[model samples]
Target: MESTQVHTLNLTSVLSVSKKIILTRYWHFVSLSILLFFPLSFSLINISSIIHLFTDDHSNNHKLLITYLLIVYILALCAIGAISYSTHHDFFGEPVKFFDSLKSLTFSFLPITSTAIIAHVIICLISLTFILLVGTILMLVHNLGFVVIDYNSVYFMWFLVIMGVILIAIVLYFYVEWSLAFVVVVVESKWGFAALMRSSYLVKGMRSVSLLVMLYFWGCGVLIVLICSTNMHAIVITTLGSFFFTMFLLRITAANTVLYNYCKALHGELELEVGEGFVHEYMNIPSEN
Candidate 1:
C-alpha cells in the first residue's frame, strides 16, 4: 500500500501490469473466476432461453425468467466485486487470497452493486433523452416546414446517420468517464453517484487511454458474441468461447483497476509502488523515458 514514487503508465503499460498480475496470480484469479464467473458464464450462455421464457405464455416461464435474471445480476455483481478487490490487492503487491476476496465482498458488494446500477440507469437515461430530443426536433422541423423531412430522402438519411454518430460519441464519452466507478467502489468504498463522480475526477486528463481500454475489451466482447452466435449448438465451441469471454472479463476488470491506480499516480493523489517482484518479473521491458 506504500510506494516511493508514482509511475505514469500508458495504455501498453496498464495492460502490461494487468497481464503480469494475472499471470503471477493466475491460480488465485482462476479460483475467483470459477466461483463467480463460471456460473455467470453459464447464465449468459443460456440468455436465449431466458428471452424465450419471457415470451412464453406460461406464468411459470415468467417466474423462471425473473428468477434467472435476478441470479444472473447477483452473479455479475459478485464477479465484478471479487475481481476488483483481488486485482487491487495484487496490483499493490499485497497478499491476495481467494477466500479473503470473497469475504471482503461482505462490505463491498452492496456498494459496488449500487454504483453499477446507478451508472446503468444514468446511461439509459442519456440514451432515452437523446432519442426523445431528436424526435422532438424532427417533429418541430417538419411542422414548421423548415425542410421536407421525407423519410426516404438522402438528406434525411444523412441526418439520421449524423445523429447516430453524435449519440455514439456521447455514450462513449460517458462510458470512459464512468469506467472506473466499480473500481472506485471496491477500492474507495464510495458507492452510487459518489463513486461515479470520483471516477469522473480520476479519469480526467486520461480519457483517451480510458477510451482505448474500453474499446479493446468491447471489441473482444463483440468477437466473443460472434463466436457464440455462430456455434450456439456446439457444446465444445460454446464452452470454450464462454471460458475465454470470462477470462477477458477478468482481464478488463483488472485493467480498469490498474488504470485507476495509474490515474491516482498521475494526479499525485497516490504513490504507487511497483513491487520488486513485478519489476523483476518484467525487467526486460524497456523503461519509459
Candidate 2:
C-alpha cells in the first residue's frame, strides 16, 4: 500500500511539472493563435479579392489588383513594424495590450516600416543579382543545347526557381527570428541602427530556442492557411473578418514572451549578462532577480 501511494505521488508530481511548463510556455501558444487568425483572415480576404477579380471586367479587375497590392504592402509594412514593437514590449515583460500596440505602431511604425522597406530592397537586390547570374547561365546552357536541338526548358527552370524560393523562405525565417524583436527595441530606444546589433547580443546563445519558437508558429500558420483555403468562396460575404484581424486578431506577444522566458532561463544557466539598464528602461518594471 505504501509503495502504491509512492507511485501515485510520483505521477502527481510529474503531471504538476508538465502543467507548470505548459503554463509558463503559454505565451508562445497565444502568439501562435494570433498568427493563425491573421492569415486565415487575410487568405479569406485575398480569396474574395480574387473572386472579384475574376468576375469584374478587365480594366476594373486590374485596378482592383493594383489597389489590393498597394494596401497589402502598406498593411504589411505597418504590421511588421507593429509586431516588432509589440513583441519587444512583451519581451521585457511589459504589458503589451492591443490598443497600446495600435497606438505605438500608428505613431512610430513608419520609421520601422521604412527600415523594413530598406531591408526588403536589399533582399530584392540580392535576388535580382542571383536571377541575373542564374539567367545568364541558363541562357548559355540553352544556347549551347540548341546546337544539340534542345533549346527549351521552361518547366524545369520554373520548378527550380520555385524550389529555390521555398528554400530561401525557410532560411529567412530562421535568420529573421531575432530581428523581428529588433524593431520594437529600436522604436522604444530611439536607436534604430543599433537595434539589430542589440538583437544579435540578446539572441547570441539562443539560436535553437528562437528556431523552435519560429517553427512552432510556422506550423500553426500553415495549418490555419490550409483550413481557410478550403472554404474560400465564403470570403466574398463580407470584409468584416479581415478588418477584425488587422485591428485585433494578430498577436505574437505570447510566443515572444515564451522565447524571452526561454532565453532568460538560458541566461541563468549559462550566466549570460544582461545590460544593466535593460530592466529599468526597456522592461518598465523592477527586475525580479
Candidate 3:
C-alpha cells in the first residue's frame, strides 16, 4: 500500500528513467523483444520487398499486404501490451516477470487493440477531413478569382507546401495527444474512445515531452529503414537493423509507460514509486500532493 510522490518530468528525465528501467529489467524486455519484436522487425526490414511484390503481382499483392498488415498489427499490439505491463509493474516497485507479463496480455490485448483501432480510425478520418477542407478552400479561392490554377507557379507551390506542413502539424498534434492510449488501456483497463480521451487528458501538460520522445524514436526508426532499404541484399545489415529496431520498440514503449505514470502523478491521479536505491536519487517522494 506504500506509494511515492511523482514529480514533473521532462523529455531528458523521461528518457533517462526509461533507459534505467530497461537496464534494470534488461532480460525481461529482451525476452519480450525477441518473442514479439524480432518477427515484427523482419517485416519492417523487408518493406522494400513488399513494395516490389506490389509492382510484380497486383492480385497477390493485395493478399500479401493484407496478411502482412494483420500479422504486424497483432504482433505490435502484443509487444506494446507486454512492455507496458512489465514497465508499469516495475515502475511501482513490484516484481516483473516475462511469463507473467505475457500472461497479463490475455486481459489487456483486447482492450489495447480496440483502443489502437479507434485511434487509427480517428486519425484517418481527421486526415481525410483536412484534405477535403483544403480542397474546398482551394476551389473557393479559384472560383472567387483570388488564385488561378497554376501548378507550376512558385506561389502556388509555396501555398501547397504551407498546407502540407499545417496538415503534418495537425496530425502530429493528435498523435502526441493519444500516444499514451494503449498504455491507458493496459494500466487503467480503459478501452477505445475512453482510453483515447484519458490519454489526451493525461498528456495535456506533457505534450511537448511526449512529442520529443516520439520524434526521437521516429527518427531512429527512419534511420533503420534507410539502412535496411539501401542495403537490401546485406543480411548482416538487415539483421542489425532489426535488432536496433526491436530495441527502439522496447525503449519507446517503456518511455511511454513511464511518461504515463509521470502524467498521472502530475495530475494527482496516481502515486508512483521507483525501486530501492534509485527512488531518492531520481524521484521526489512527497508526503502528499
Candidate 4:
C-alpha cells in the first residue's frame, strides 16, 4: 500500500515507481475493480486444479496446456491494459467508468496486446536459439578434442550455469526495455507493431529505471511461486496468495502506465487525448430501441 501523496512524472527512483503503484484509487473505478476481482475468484475456485496441473507432471496434455496458458497470458495482458488505462485516466484528471475502458480494450487494445505478446515470444525464441548455439559450440569444441576442458568437470558445469544466467539477464533487460508497449497502445492508440516500437523508443535511456521496476515484479512473482509451492494444501494461504498475486500484477500494470506517461512527458510527447474515454462512451451509446 502507498501513502497518500501526489505523484510527479519524474520517476528517478524505485520509491517514485512504488508511489505510482500505491497511490492510485483503483477501488473508485468500480468497473475496473470488478475486472480485477474476477481473477481472484477464478483462482479460488480453480486453485486445486491449478495446483494439480503444475505439481502432477503425469498429465499428458502438454500441447493443450500450453495453448490454454498462451490464451490466458494474452487475456491477462489485455486486462492489464484496461486496468492501467483506468489508472492513467484518473491520473490525467479524466476518470472514466469501467465500460469506457472495456470499450477501448475490446475495439482497439487486443490487437496491440497480441502483437506485443508475439514480439516478446519471438525475442525469447531468438534468445533461446542463441543460448543453444553457444552451448552446442561449447559441447562440440569439447567433443572434438579442440579444448582441454572436461565436460564433466565442476568448473565447466559452473561455466555453463553462469552462461545461462547471463543469457537470461540479457533477455530480461529487453523485456523491461519494451515493457510499456501495452500501455503505449492503450494511451496512444498505437496499432500492431507500432506500440512495440513506441515502447522501445520511450524506454530509451531509461532502461535502468525500467529494470528496477521489472525487478520488483520479478520479486513478487518469485514470492508468489514460493508461497504456492510451500502451502499448496492450505486453502486460506492459497486464496490469499492468489489475491496478493493479482494485486501485484495490477500494481505492475499501474507502474508501467505511469512510466509510459512519464517517458512521454520527458520527450514532450505526452498527448493523453483528454476525453478519449468520453469519445468511446459516446460511440458506445446505443440508440433507444
Best by TM-score: 3
Per-residue lDDT of model 3, residues 1-289, tens digit only:
2233344456778888878888888988999987888778777888778657754754556667777768877988999999999988777667577889999999999898888888889889998999999999889988999978887899889988999999899999999999999999998899999998999999988898899999999899878978887897898998888888899989899999988988876776653333232244335533321
Better of 2 and 3 by TM-score: 3
Per-residue lDDT tens digits for candidate 4, residues 1-289, read 0111112222344334435434545464334534544454345445567656855768756676556556566556667767777867765656677577777777556667676767768787978798888979887897898988876899989988898798888788668767888777777778567877888899876676678777877687667857675776777876767666666666667777766765665565533542243223211222221
For model 4, name the residue pairs that clash: none
Cα lDDT tens digits, model 2, 190-254, are 43445444455556555554555455555554555555556555754334445444333333333
Residues 214-260, model 1: lDDT tens digits = 88987987788676857778888778877887887788888898889
Candidate 4 — worst ten consecutive residues by lDDT sum? 1-10
Give the TM-score ranking, best first.
3, 1, 4, 2
Query: What is the number of residue pairs that collide in model 4?
Result: 0
- Per-residue lDDT of 185 in model 2: 47
lDDT of model 1 at residue 166?
Answer: 97
TM-score of 2: 0.57
* Model 4 residue 237 distance off true place after TM-score fit, in angstroms: 0.6
Clashing pairs in 3: none
Collision pairs in model 1? none
Residue 236's lDDT within candidate 3 is 92
Candidate 2 deviation (Cα RMSD) = 9.7
lDDT against true structure, model 4 = 0.64
Write down the TM-score of every candidate: 0.88, 0.57, 0.89, 0.76
